[model samples]
Target chain A: MKQKTITQSLSWLHTWSGLLFGWVLFAIFLTGTLAVFDKEIDNWLRPEIPAHSLDSREAAQTALDYLQARHPHARTWNIGLPNERAPTLSVSTGEQRRGGGQALDPETGELLQVRETAGGGFFFRFHFTLNLPRLLGIWVVGLAAMAMLAALVSGIVIHKKFFKEFFTFRPAKGQRSWLDAHNATGVLVLPFHLMITYTGLVIFYLIYMPAASDALFGGDREALNRALRGMPEQHAGQGRQPPQEVAGPAPLTALPPLLAEAERVLGPLASLSIHNPGRGDARIEVRPLLGNRIELTKGQSMVFDGVTGKVLRAPAESRPSLLTQRVLAGMHFAQFGGYPMRWLYFVCGLASCAMIATGLVLFTVKRRRRHDGEGALGAALYTGAERINVSVVAGLALACVGLLWANRLLPFELAQRGGWEVRVFFLIWLATLLHACLRPWLRAWQEQLGLTAALCLGLPLLNVVTVNRGDYIPLEVTILVIGGLLAACAWKIGQPAPERALRVRTEVN
Target chain B: MGLAIATGLWLAYSGMIALCLGLERHYKQVWGRPPSSSRRRALRATGWLALAASFAASVAAWGWAMGPIGGLGLVSLAGLALVLVLPYQPRLAIGTAVAGWPVLALATLAG
Candidate 1:
């Protein structure tokens, strides 16, 4: 065998690593992009919550009255205050309920009987976990992320004309076009690709790489956390102590005033947790809504004596190292810079998806031309890769949009409706894989993409007919744009191959 | 804030156009002729200046902490938009950046 150059080895590494993890990364990127607007999607899925603007103080008061009337003796009362993005007050007692407690109308304290659907949280959770069991999925995703990092570095090393071909893209030339697109998107958005991949790993740093924590703290993450936060071990331990007998039960201090004070210090408050709601020793912890800054203040909160309404401790200033990690994780979370920043992240995320998709396509397009010289196994592998690419890429798009259709069409009172929606999503995805396996290659690509376009384009009509809500305008408009793009793709895929085009031209001449 | 964001995005796009056109090949691709060394030098300098100004504008729009982060995003997208458009409609790509300035100025002055 000829001695392979370093570039050739790296090129092999990039192609194989990219192919192996590319599907997972594509799924991760697509859903992560959708999760950028998770809150909006959450709203669209749950149209029962009427849109309203109200004072945070006022909203907290309503939640307080509702909780006081119903769960006065509950150990802890957690209230999720309404904001512009999520305009529904919610209340839970003791432990936090999944799906963010029960939705309460912000205007009135009436409990809204919203349909039980997965909401946009499905995308957010699936983005990282791929609907696998939490730990396994996270580990799988982490492995994929590491592979992506390796691939990106290897890709940079192998590309010969990195700077020379900075703005080069020549379309409609088949393999050359695909390679140009792959290079263009990958190089142009290189910073975002690297940042997103690196930061995504960092978000689960301790979970993925427990070596440092394991060595220093004997794998006691809570202890490590307390040390990082500069917490007195005893004081931090007290915060986690289960509800115990405190001073004789007393009337809770007025919450609106406390909310106002907390908001002043912490910016807009997301939720308030009143520990021992009716007791003299009650402590109220108010957490600031994220997006006030680039650093994710995830667990940062102001603690107040619930009876006296006096500040017990201001949100602890993050020790410097923790702040650095939080800021990096914050970039991945994208909870800063308001809507414009979110939009930029969304667009960059889509570009990242394009880069990966183009790379996958380019692999198949390159291999297709050389299949004649291949052994049976090689040909089989090539065919397998081609089918897998179609199913994973186009099929995922179909499933994602199919999820919205499920959320709308499923009967509101159906038992396990959310689970059914998820099942529907998977079913659509599986069906596309079967379709890809059965249909001819070109036909399969055209049909699946065309169906995804139809679903995406018809989403507004589906929404109008089923839910009849205008609140999904932004989500619907975005889907329409994606639909238009996919429609164009389907049309392109339906066209005759280049060799056929050449033959027709010769015939005409 | 809206004007600031618009101006910042326009400046970033114009800056990317300048940097792209600073290269002899891209300069020839659009203008159909190679530029003199001095002209290329001027274009490169102007590109860097516009990018710096775009950073300042991003700061104005998103505040000090987020400006640098958001500014990078703006510049990246501006380059992406430029590259995609350059191959198909090179003059139109540069023209939009040129035309944006007066419209932005009018919007700024109206405020």
Candidate 2:
């Protein structure tokens, strides 16, 4: 009896927790899944930047020269070498700016004329930030992740037949089928779900659980960061002396030799940062591009004296705790994986989204069979829940595809074009919510899903008419095919039920 | 390489589904009668062996860490596939498991 009560309480906890944040969680999961291909999506969105190949050393040199001319006295010069994934030389000086910094064509070192669009970056940022104020958004997402972890735990506690029903599925049985699917997907990918949620929390641990760091570092966040990143401990009076005067500008050491040496030791170079360039105190740091290694940290880097090209500091050997934390972060961000692994993550993510959606539907389906028409309040609540279900599940999908259409249809030279694209996304999403409240639940589902299908299927045609870029033709066609299939499914769903058909037939007779 | 890995995944996944179906309770639920004891034993043994072989194949294709992760996803997909097929064509589901192993073996050897 005690065990039964515990299980019942856990079940209640799971259901309520899941329902409270299901919509936001769904959006986060879907967007995060898409973000796995962020670079590819970025390529598709900006068609102006033609693809080109350039040597890493040459690209670095080009970026440095451009930065020298543009911001000669800037405190820091950070040059990102072009690679296979992102084929543009990116340079940022001084403080980091909002969105992306200036990008240059590797071949000519000229500023790129790429169209302004958020592309997949919007989804990636929205997954955690939700377009809200940075601190608030992180806190809210952290809370949701915590709730998800609690729900997963409580759900496992409540489920008695874990293994016996591992592969169970009873389709067409309404609530039973939903429960089975929820269980199957949840249990099958439980490890992934847990890892993602926990690591998501860990990524923002200093913000979420700052007590330990605060106490340890005496409320110094920078110190805490240095400790976490395993930077060399600072000593008093290390650089307290006045800046040394030099005749005109110091002749800087050649970067190509340093680049070649770093590449030989650390694989392909991703980025190089020169601090206090053209000065005796100047330091150069080179970071390698991330590869398919299981390690969380990208390969080791080398810091060189900017003037003499002498080795200053090699990459710090990460402590075990830091390495573990990095691994967790890497798993969540999927920085150490290839295309195949990314595809696998995408599929698993979709399955998780399906699991959540089915669970939400099951809640209403189970209740409608019992207390649906019991009273005025019960009926009103049922209607509201049904509306929310249709809007959140199908409507969000419609809004996403609509955003893509806005990207294609919007005038290229329009001011704040990227901002307008985001606005169109929210506008469509809000419209769906309003429509869901006004229309019958069944009609809302059918209309929204049908619209989603039409928009998705029409995207490629719109592309042909407008941008006509051959780079993303195959991907666009795939989206069109998926949209068409979804449309067919929606049409099938919109058909009258067998019982309704029989009633209509009898009335006609 | 992609094809070979995908084939191995399918073999592992189908094998897992067959193992689940080998249980007498599940068999009874599906066919409305319990399978014979000897047939049940055979099914169970074959199911376990096939699953082991699939794991080996997966590991051979991908490394240990990724192989298990990929296997988990593939198994869930196979379970879903089984759910969709069993209600309409139970025999075909069984046949998939029976035929998957040999094809997987051939592909592994060729690769």
Candidate 3:
């Protein structure tokens, strides 16, 4: 065995680790980018909610009136206010604060007959969880995020001509072009890559690294959460008790004034929940919209007395340490700076996906040249790796658009339609892997990318035939642009072979 | 706000072009000649100045808190656009940057 220099060792680490985790990272990045417009996508998925310009207070009152009449005995009544981005008021009755809501037309106060679909929330969930069980998915994604951080650091360490090749890129040179693109995208968007990855890990910090929690709190997550909220530890083991029935139902206070006061304080409201609705001891908790600030106020709320409409507890100001954590999480969440900032995050995320995809392709391109020198086993492994690369990259993209197609194409009255949509997504992805394994490499890439392009380009027509709404023009336009790009990529893949690339290089020289 | 953001993006693009041209290899690639030391120094200085102005515009558009974050993204994307364009259309890359001066002036007056 020969001694290896630090750069050589780290270079080896970078290549293998990146290839091992690159597929998962690509999925995470692609879905995270889509999650940037989750609300808009949600709106598109459920087109029953028409776009409207309703005042928040008026909408809140309407939701209150509706909930009061229908769910008078419910323990908690939640009302999701319509906003500029999502113009659908939702009211749900449940023991929990969130989950299982019904959409309502804010103008008519009637329940909307919306079809069940997976919505853009699937992407947001899969971004962090990879469609695995909740805890298991988080751990898997946490490992992938760590691998990304490792790759970024080692990639910088091994690149000898960092500054000299800052803006260098040469097309039509095959392997060199891939390396250049990998370097350019990775380096140019380095800040976003680092910030997004680090913050993603920070979001589940205690779960990923529980040593501090274990050492201090004996590994009791509930106790740690109680202490963080400044709650007394004596009540740590006691779970939330269902609200006891009062002697008699009483008239609740008018919600418009409370909504006004809350709006004055919290900027714009997203939703409000009333505990023990119509009971004498009722309480109203108002939560602000997510994008009002860079710090995620996920659990922050203003509590008010239901009878007197007086403030019981205003939203707590995060301490410096908590604020730092929240801001970092918020950066990854990207719910601040309105649409423009979200667009920036989306572009950077696409670049990140491109960076990972290029790195994966570069691995195979580099290996293909040396495969003949290696034995039969190595050649077989190389072939397997190449097929896996195609399936993971192009396959996942096809599955994503296929999910949207399923939302529209599937039977509207079908039971559990959302579940079926997700199943369609996975089935498409699996089918792509099989196709890639069976077909020739170029044809596999060309066919899958071409199908994805056709699906994306055809989405507007599908929406028209099924949903028949003009509100989602922006989403359709964006899909069309992506389709055009994918078509270009498919065309390029079909045109260029290794021999042609070699010939072009020779001609240039 | 729209004018401010447009100015920010244009200046960021122009700044990245200046910085790219300051590098001797990129300079030769675009202009078919290597830049002298003084020319390169001037280009680098101009690049930094344009970037600073772009930061100001970003701040004007998004305010102090989110300004720097968005500004960095603008500059990075501008650099990325420059890199991708230089390989395929080197003349158009520099040509657009050079043409941005009038647009920047119009944005300044309107803003």
Candidate 4:
């Protein structure tokens, strides 16, 4: 009896926790899933950047030349080498807050005419940040992740016939079908779900569990960071005198030799950062590419004197704890995996999303039969939940596809173009919410899903007309096919029930 | 390599579905009668063998570290597909299991 009560209470906890945060969790999961292909999306968005064979040395030289001409006496210079997905050299100076960067064509060193759009990077940012204020969004996402963990644990505790029901699905049985799908998807990918949520929390451990660092390092964030990363604490340009004269120091040594040396030590280099450039106290930092290693933290790096191109410091050997943390983070972010692993992650992510969606739908389906005609608060709650279900599930899908349409249709020179695309997403979602409120729940679902399907299916044609790019047509067509199938499912869902069908037939007779 | 792994995964998935249906209770729901005891035993054994073959094929395709992860992913996907298929087409599901053996053999030989 005691164990039974514990299981019952756990069941209650799982249901409530999942219901309360299901919509936000769904959005996060969908965006994060899309972010697995962020680099490909970036390439598709910037059609002007034709694919090119990456020559890291040449790319680095172009970036250095661009930065020297642009920010001759700037405090810092960062250059990102061209890679497989993004075949362009990206150079930026100053801090991220003072955003000034451009993508240079790898072949010509000329700036590409790429529109100012966030592309897949926007979804990547929204995954964690939710496009809100930085600290607030991180805290909110972290809380949701914690809630997901709780739900996952309670769900496992409550499930009795876990393995027996692994391959069970009885369609058209209403709540039973939903429950079966939820159980099957959830149990099958339970490992992946747990790993993703835990690592997501760990990624923002500083924000989520700041008390540990505060107590251990006396609230010195940098010191705490250095300790956690297992690296020596070395401030940039430490104990250096400020330059008095306006004239800059002599031209810095060429980056080719330095890059070659850094590559020799640490495989292929990803990016190079020059701090205090053109000053006597200048230093260069080189970060290695993420190449098929299961380590999560950014790859090992080397520091060198800017003028002499001599190695100053090699990366410290990470402690076991640090290495474990990095591995977890790496698995969660999937930086080490190639294309197959990435696709696998994407599919698993989709399965997780399906699990959450089915759970939410099952809650209402189970209750609707018991409360449909009851003239009580229960029915009212059911109606409200149904509306929310339609709007969140189908409506968000519509909004996402709508964002892609906005991206293609919006003028190239439109002011704040990226902001407009996000606005389109929210506006469509808001419109669907209003529509769901006004229309019958079933009708609302059909309409929104149908719209999403249409938009997804039409995206390729829109792309061809607007960008005239044939390279990405195959991918767009695949998405369209998926959308078509979703639309068919929506249509089926909107059909009348057996009882309703019998009643209509009798009336017609 | 991709084709061989895909074929191996399908064979394993079909075998899992057949094993599930070999039980008297689930067999009645699908085919309106319990399977024969001997047939049930055969089905269960076949399922285990197919899964073992799938593991070997996956390991051969990907290395030791990635093979298990890939195999797990394939199982999940196949399980989902089987669930979706079993409700409406019970006979088709069993037939798929029988057909999968030859395909698996072909994939292995080709590799």
Candidate 5:
């Protein structure tokens, strides 16, 4: 095949494959970006969910009592402790109402101040769901993940100058500039590209390649879960069972002391779990899972029998799968944690988005000179694509920022507040896309971009309109991000040289 | 069915403009000679509108031609499909598949 054919073939591969999975990847990027401060966002959303004053054990005791009393037959329970991002102590007694789950006051047995607490879980779930049907979303996202992995690896192989131009970024070259941006972003954050993609696959590995089980353990979900989770059931009945109910109000140890002791022994407990706290079978599990700060992607969990107050079994950390799963999880979630690593992942994540955006631009840029070499028809197509690229890229930014604006501005009493917020997002994007397509290339580019810039630049001022989160909420971070994005957009459309380089060259000729 | 519905909706939503543009898109793909006549321009416009409308009609008739996943879902999968059919891949087919499908689907989901 000719060099051009090969490039064309890659182009075809690049174009169709990219459009297919672009949206899902976009969601992942969007959500994952928000997930960086998932906890903080959760707190911002749920103002009423109270902080836990009592220790994990105290909260555990109240939550346990609620669970045992309300959902004695629940199959499983999950307790998430308060963190820097979220102050609420939460308990899910059962999957269903019958199974009984509620967030309880850490000190009092009273019901938690619940107010539609979707919190960061919304973004977490949106990562997988893409707002599609449940498991379907997973499979779809999983497939896209594979595409990303392929794109990363193949992109490197196909580019002979991958190493030669590793640091090359020339802004005035139009399409060359987009190519540089794509290549630079892709190459510079290649580790992130690889880590995020591979890890993302692992994060949803069970769904993506359920065969990991077949290949390793013969396709058994239980076997896989047990193997990955490290033989949880085996240790369950090693000790004697406590009574079905609390044996006459046993005045257990105060939670604060237990928490202090647990912190002392386990080292500032990362996550706390409560199991059957009031029932004789009640237990409090203190999780010393390594956070993003430290490095424990494969978590280490310690179970404390609630009634006995004895650390039942201290299973020294066991083996975790090093195969794609562990390593991928570590890389994807930055689970082997730390602030520095988190920031690193965050930067890489943003770069990954930049890489995609650049690729889109490059697709148009390479074909850009066709106006002169190719003719008016070529220029027209170029103009059309340019409008689209602008719409999709900057349009998406506008929608995102608009959503934040809606969150602040939408009156709490507004019926369908959540739905309306979502609707507003789509409506704005649709309108922008339409507006972009209607204008001529240059005008559309500048105007749509200008609109995007205006929205972003005005965000900080918009926040100031409400005394709620916008006014009282921290502005420095929001201001910087919004300002930075607006500046970048402005530079892209407003900068004159890249678009005019060819014209000047033609004139010189 | 989901994909079909989505495709139909997209066409319903943005098809006319995209198709008219896409018509020029197809025309621009021709090698050597550039199309210049008024007749050719009208023909291209009509041709593209037909194609876009047919696609929308197909989805409308088929209810989910894009598969259960939806039309946008097909976008990423189409990338994989093209790779499968394309000859002389630079092994970057894998990378294209890797980066394209998910990125496409992710953006679709956001929409």
Candidate 6:
């Protein structure tokens, strides 16, 4: 094959593979991008959920008492202890009635807080898998990440001007405009792209390549886990709790003392988890979130043997290891980089979506032209693939952004807010796919892109109207980001006919 | 809890299977001749084993900072870097430098 043949084949491969993974990639990028501000958003969304409140131990125990009362025979209990990020403590009793996990309140044991939690960690969780069941979302994304890695490799292999095109972006010039968009998205945010893809794959490396364990670990995941599970203390249970009745909550340690000692010992308790609270074995563990004034924390658990108040094994405190992981966390989360980095990542993420978006558009662009000589069977197959691309990419964005629209419209006190949020997301996406399928190619692109742009542009206004933040409150950073992106989209979708842009640029030259 | 994790497990299973299919296609596309059917089968079998191994490693890596998959991310990032170098060998030295350094810095800050 001629070099041109190689280039074309790779381009063919990149375009199609990328289109296949585009929606998932966009979800991953968007969610992952938002996940960079996971903490900030958590802070923003759940303003009612107090920060630096009392650790979850007292709360966890209080929750545990209720859950234990509800289902004492549960084989196991898991308490989602809370801290700075989420003040609401949640408790899960084992085998309550069936396998289904039951929810409980932290304080007062009055079934604390549960309404369609669209805010807390919902956006964070929504990324990668669109909050699908773990297996479904993870696999879809893992496969996409693999495809993305392949596309990245093939994209590099095929680009003739890899270096010359570095940092070169020319606005609106036919396919050069498209190619520039691709190169700019890929290269300018090269670090973000590379880091995200690599980290994304690594984030789920074992799931994607379990063989690495056998070859790498020589067997026995437990021992390997021992090496890595940072705080062995967390796993070592606070001695066995004897049987307990609903004590209607007893005197628990005042959170203020715990906080002070916790800070003195563990460097400001970022979070607290209490198991079997208000019992003989009621355990309280104090730990830092991002440790005070010293370093970004990779949490350390000093489990207090509930009855004795003895510290458990705050083990695996390797400064080097912790620091390395923090950086990885930083790169992945975009926390260390702050607002500028956040915006950079957000843009990069959008660019990543744009990369997929443009790549998907390019698929149709290449196909719509008069096929020089490809056969009908080949054309049909190609056309079918384009159809899926249109529905999946544009449709998927419609689903995601539409969920935000849904959040506004959905009854706030609805019993299943989380469920409804997810449902609306899928429903919107599904509708888009169906609409794309029903429409002509050109119309599908224009209309869906137009709606997406409109939705994105209007997101901030909707938030302002629904959430009713005072004008005194500056623009929510997230809303501002969305507004900018939506405007960009509206511009892209509403750009004049290609011939016009070409004629204008050509005439100018 | 274990059953809930099974979803992630199945995901691993599907990815390995798809990877086999993808690699088979990729090799065929590259070499013109199809990879031997038996070889593809072998790759599938190996892929399963790799999937299982990586799963265990990930579980182990949990909570350990550069824990399970993060290490893999580091390595894969490196591998992908090498793959991208093929089309621009002259720029490799500079390219790797430009790419590799930030990761190194992140590793430092993360630690």
Query: Candidate 3 or 4, higher TM-score?
Result: 3
lDDT-based ranking: 1, 3, 4, 2, 5, 6
State TM-scores per candidate.
Answer: 0.96, 0.88, 0.95, 0.87, 0.66, 0.64
The residue-by-residue lDDT of candidate 4 on A63-116, one tens digit each, is 887788878877878888877556657888765221246778777776778776
Please, what are the lDDT tens digits per residue for candidate 2 over residues A1-509? 45557888888888877887877787778778878777777776777666776889989999999988988898678888787676767899864343356778877888987777868788898889887898998998888888888988988888889888876777655567779888987887787788788988988877888899878998887787577667766521122334566434676789999999888877777888887787777778888876544456653567888888988776666788877777677778875446666767777787778877887877776776556348778767766777788888888888777877888788888999999989998899889999999876667878998999999888778878887864776567667776987798689767876754453344223
Provide the lowest-lDDT 10-residue window in model 6 chain A: A94-103
DockQ of each: 0.75, 0.41, 0.80, 0.46, 0.01, 0.02
Predicted candidate 6 versus true structure: per-residue lDDT over A181-232, tens digit per residue: 6765565445556677876665555566668567767765654545555435
Off by over 4 Å in 3: A97-99, A231-249, A496-509, B104-111
Q: After superposition, how far is residue A493 of candidate 5 from its true place, in Å?
A: 1.4
Can you give the lDDT of residue A484 in candidate 6?
Answer: 63
Model 2 has an lDDT value of 0.76
C-alpha local distance difference test of each model: 0.89, 0.76, 0.88, 0.78, 0.56, 0.56
Estimate the TM-score for candidate 6.
0.64
lDDT of 2 at A419: 94
lDDT of 3 by residue, A36-142 (tens): 99988888888777888889888888888898788777878888888878888889986444536888888888898999999989999999999999999999999
Task: Give the true-structure RMSD of model 3.
Answer: 3.0
**TM-score comparison, 3 vs 5, better candidate:** 3
Displacement of residue A369 (Cα, Å) in model 1 is 0.7
Candidate 4 Cα RMSD (Å): 4.1
Candidate 1 lDDT by residue in tens digits, A366-448: 88767658878987887788888898899999999999999999998899999999999999999998998888777788999
Best by TM-score: 1
Error of 6 at A481 (Å): 4.8
The alpha-carbon deviation from the true structure for residue B105 of candidate 2, after best TM-score superposition, in angstroms, is: 6.5
- Cα deviation at A297, candidate 6, in Å, is 6.8
